[model samples]
Target: MTITLHHLRYSRSTRIIWLLEELDIGYSIVEHHRDETTNRSQDDLFAIHPLGKAPAVDVDGRVMMESGAIIEYLIETHGAGKLGVAPGEAERSAYLEWMQFTEGTLAMPVLLTMLGPRFGGLDKLPLLQGFVGGEVTKLLDYVDAHLEGREFLLESGFTGADINMEYLLELINLTGMLDQRPNAKSYLERLMARDAYKRAIEIGGPLVKLPG
Candidate 1:
């Protein structure tokens, strides 16, 4: 299969890059740059997928979007028994939960919390800020507690779930949100240290820059 990854620098697509390196697959990348003024995706991505999102993979000719789906597909098709928790496996439920949690539950508030200032500082939207803040706290606390004694999301080490969850954790970490969650902080540290992740950073650029 000819695999082509449409990658956006500093976006969640880096997760796919890291996973591809981990899987040791031969694939090519079609790099896309964000619009400087808007910081939104450029027209190059629009030609690949209708939504013009990064992390879209062209497998042999069919385009696939959605990071979670792409991650799951890559694992099932190309993973070679690596980075996946099989059906009926002991950690299957936890694996699926954490894998989906990044986008399904954590994305809205996390994105709003990070990008809310672009619209207006959270101060300007007090109620929305309050709701988003509450959700962020609740979700972070849950993940932190889950990571207390675990090295990865599941008892089995280093699955796709980690790839799914760690990208969001990296964003939060950059904003200093992981400090209070020691377990999560430690887990993030461990994940960032992986060679595949380092390669992803080198290939795709850092996951957003630190505030000046």
Candidate 2:
């Protein structure tokens, strides 16, 4: 099957590029850059998906959105003895939990921490920054605790869950809260050391390091 990824520069879509490389599949990447000042996805993305989001892929003829969903789809379609744990495996539940947790649980705080400072009046409020910063730090601690003594989330080697998680942790790290969590820091370092991840960077561009 043919796969074409509609990628946004310096966004979560880069995680998909990493996965595609790990899957060892042949797929084309179509890059969409954010406006330099506005830092918004180009209007062209709306033509691909109604929500106009990145990490949208054209799989054969169907258009798919959401980074988590796309990762699962690729794993189901292309991952066998690689990148994912098949159904009925004991690790499957943990794998699913982490995949969902990355976007569902972790992403919310990161979003708030980022957007809270950028919105007009809120930027002037120290209270807003303290509340959001505290929340992000707590969540980072929870994740770092989960990562202790493990190379991957599910304990079945590096699966798609790592791909889902590393992006969020990297974003959290940029806040400087990451250095406090040693396990979390090393976990990210390990993922980046992968050649697939490096190659994905070459194709999709680097992930965004600073919070907006």
The most accurate candidate by TM-score is 1
Q: Model 1, 114-199: lDDT tens per residue?
A: 88777879989889888999999999999999988989888889998898888788877767889999999999999999999999
For candidate 1, what's the RMSD?
Answer: 1.1
RMSD of 2: 2.2
List the global CA lDDT of all models: 0.90, 0.86
Off by over 4 Å in 1: none
Best by the lDDT measure: 1
Error of 2 at 168 (Å): 1.5
lDDT of 2 by residue, 26-116 (tens): 9998888888788888788888988889999999989999888999989999987788877898888888888899888889878777566
Q: Provide TM-scores for the models.
A: 0.97, 0.92
State the weakest 10-residue window (summed lDDT) of model 1.
166-175
Task: Return the lDDT, model 2, position 54.
Answer: 92
